[model samples]
Target: MGNSNDLRSKSLWMDIEVAPDARPLEGDQACDVIIAGSGIAGISTGYELALKGLAVMIVDRGRIAGGITARTTAHLAPLCDDLTSEMIKLRGEEISRAFYESQAAAVDRIEAVQKREAIDCDFRRLDGYLFQALNTDSKIIDDELDAVRKVGAPVHRLVGVPLAHCGNQHALRYPRQATFHPLKYLKGLAEIIEAKGGVFYSETIVREIEERKDGSVAAKTDSGVITAKAAVVATNSPIVDTLALHTKMAPYRTYAMAFAIKRGAIPDALYWDTLDPYHYVRLQPGEGAADTLIVGGADHKSGEADDADLRFEALEAWARNLIPAAKNVTHRWSGQVLDTIDYAGFIGRNPGSQNIYVHTGDSGQGMTHGVAGSLINSALILGDTAKWQEVYEPTRKTPSGIGNFVRENLTAVKNFAEYLAPGELKSLDDLKPGQGAVVRQGLSKIAAYRGKDGALHARSAACTHIGCHLHWNSFETCWDCPCHGSQFAVDGTALNAPAVSALADVKTGD
Candidate 1:
């Protein structure tokens, strides 16, 4: 487990394949709408609107379809992992039925995309599992199974031989659920989007989106502006509307380790545990080695701990217990998602704004809810009626919503603490090789680093997005935030999306 391979860093899904047509936003763009992300939601929604005769434009800060789509475990199933039964408790059986139905439709939506476009991303209709562990509450799954049956989703009790000892209670089996390569499917649809009159711009960072007096919205970018009738903030967590949208969705860090195990070591069906901090496992096709087992889900508050390795270790132990013979761990990586208070996603107009829509707070089930978000926003933008509109409406509220809102707001305390926390090292010169430092300078903490060139350089540690302090990440040689998931290079350059703005400056001596 201590081997570097067991705790891999980059995305296994991406390292294995290549999508050559991927490009960046080159210049100014104009269209009926400007989609702000290249993930599944942004790409698919843009394609849908393009086919409907609207002139659409898609833009990404980096290469198209390179964000979450690149690293997703891609569990394409309709079993709402968290919100299925919670909906029944909070709202009623009808909304509960709708919630389950929404996921079922998400599974079908992926299937429909593959069929209609004839994509060859290895899309397969397989059984999905939500297993209960010893530490999990059985009542939750019991209630969810009833909803699954009522909604006629393919889920029920099934006993798995390999996992019978982990307090193996009755499982919810969703039949016809799928698994696929996210980037492959997205790249396939990107072609269709362009062919359907949609414009795409890479390297074009959308700065701000606001409504004008004449009723059109303006999307200011680096090179030029895109004024459209409507705007969609599909930039993962809605990079705009910082105070409102970021507060509702708290970021959670989850780890994934794809390892090659001996043949027939893992059961083919996708499996997930019902533990408090759960784990999900699945198998993917591979060659010249053991089967690739993707074990994921060790959720933590993003950037708050900085001990992702410990979480990765916990995952290794979990895997060894299930399959002690497994070895040759090839890749390890992590992703962050916006978790909602209601344990569901927020998809629709950004509550107070007019004609500006957002889709986030997907929890760990981002794939299914992401699809749901696209449909919800598309329906709202087109004013098409759908039963899912109300439940996932951005303006809607519940007791859980209020609770989640408060829970997410506590990050303000973490951010406040960062401004005052003690330095890890005395000074920039003290930084060891292959290391980064955050030191205080006139009440402003600077993210100083000893570069690979062995020279020390410093920059304002303040995150350009919302002024949160940035911490040094040893593993990635980047400055990461416990706040809204903005990542930056060691020298204060933006490496990830949603920030789009570079750090203020650098002061170097030594």
Candidate 2:
């Protein structure tokens, strides 16, 4: 039997040893711009702002690039995850063109930075393919091709892919897309930012962001306060906004697994399918180690179901079915993606806050949207204009997405019914070591986990964010909120937001 003390969940992309480090905040620090996250959005924005000679400070609750950026497949595709066909249907032709152009420009910016800075992160320009499965309609392919062409994508129809068991006969091949090591790129950018006089602080959790009447913003963290002329909330979901941003976007948990493969077993290109929850694939040159093939998909709303292991299983099955040689599954991890109802990201000024900006709702295009957002935010903060500024303005409303907004919010509201339902376990005795369960105790639910020594640790089941009931996630070893996707560690320290506060500890006897 395997050791019960081991939970066995981690990101394969984060297996690298060397990374940039910074000290935690000690006292009140000041800068021209304070970024609350250190993922792609925060780092890229900080880097750009530093280049413009702005005194920038980036802070994160964890290590730099430790959040969702490390969880990305690192595919820098010209195509958007929400799909060009869907964007055309939701936002029409003009807005779709703008969205496509912005992502394309973002890819170009990444390539340019790699060249200009001489950063070595395995950045490569390769072809990308979006194909249809045997059961999917051919018209979907036609629709996507038409939409991408309208946006000036260098793509054409392909009769078939040159891979084993790819399951598709028709495809759209887009040239000049790219992929890279996300964390390595972040490290390069962080070093440059430091050289340019930007400051970075890790393990500094910001409790809240306050906008003063004097036109300055202060981020209240556990260590100290950080005052700045402007603040950027680049966290995957906005912890600062309770209702405005949360209601417009829904959080989804996507699973990815890296498989050990022989070199050249799979073609060195990015591949995606037209499945509802579509699969995305890329080949990573493992350097000295075994070449890795990364495949990601199996997305579902966060905390909606406690089936992470099942999702990983399905993903592996899909990969093995497509590529028989992908036999060894090396790593599996899940990351949250915020889906915007409007088919684009919100990357400009936050609503009702003049000095505060946000970059959220990336819709599974974090690598592209993160950098694109940084470019727009930096330009706007410098009192300049970006050509696509209006495209991602946070306050803009799209009538077309009203249906999605209503549907997603309705689902969130329905999630509240979990509070009234029966708990997953009748008593703490039902919990196994290294496992957690929600147990009902005298009209209240308690999130209970058993340690390896069989001692019980308990926390209030109510989410610190909204009062939705919390679910025990066995794979991640965390208490996850079904309503807004807030996650807490086994000991109840908040790990993710829309919940900044930790779950209240509960006395098992009291």
Clashes of each: 8, 0
Residue 314 error, candidate 1, Å? 2.0
Q: What local lDDT score does residue 274 receive in model 2, on the 0 to 100 scale?
A: 86
Model 2 lDDT tens row, 333-380: 888888989768999899999999999998899999999999999988
lDDT of 2: 0.84
Candidate 1 whole-model C-alpha lDDT, 0 to 1 = 0.73
RMSD of each: 3.8, 2.6
Q: Kindly report which residue pairs in candidate 1 clash with one another.
A: 8-332, 24-202, 25-201, 25-202, 25-203, 154-174, 155-173, 156-173
Model 1 lDDT per residue over 70-96, tens place? 667888767556646665666666766
lDDT for position 102 in model 1: 83
The superposed Cα distance between candidate 2 and the true structure at residue 154, in angstroms, equals: 1.5
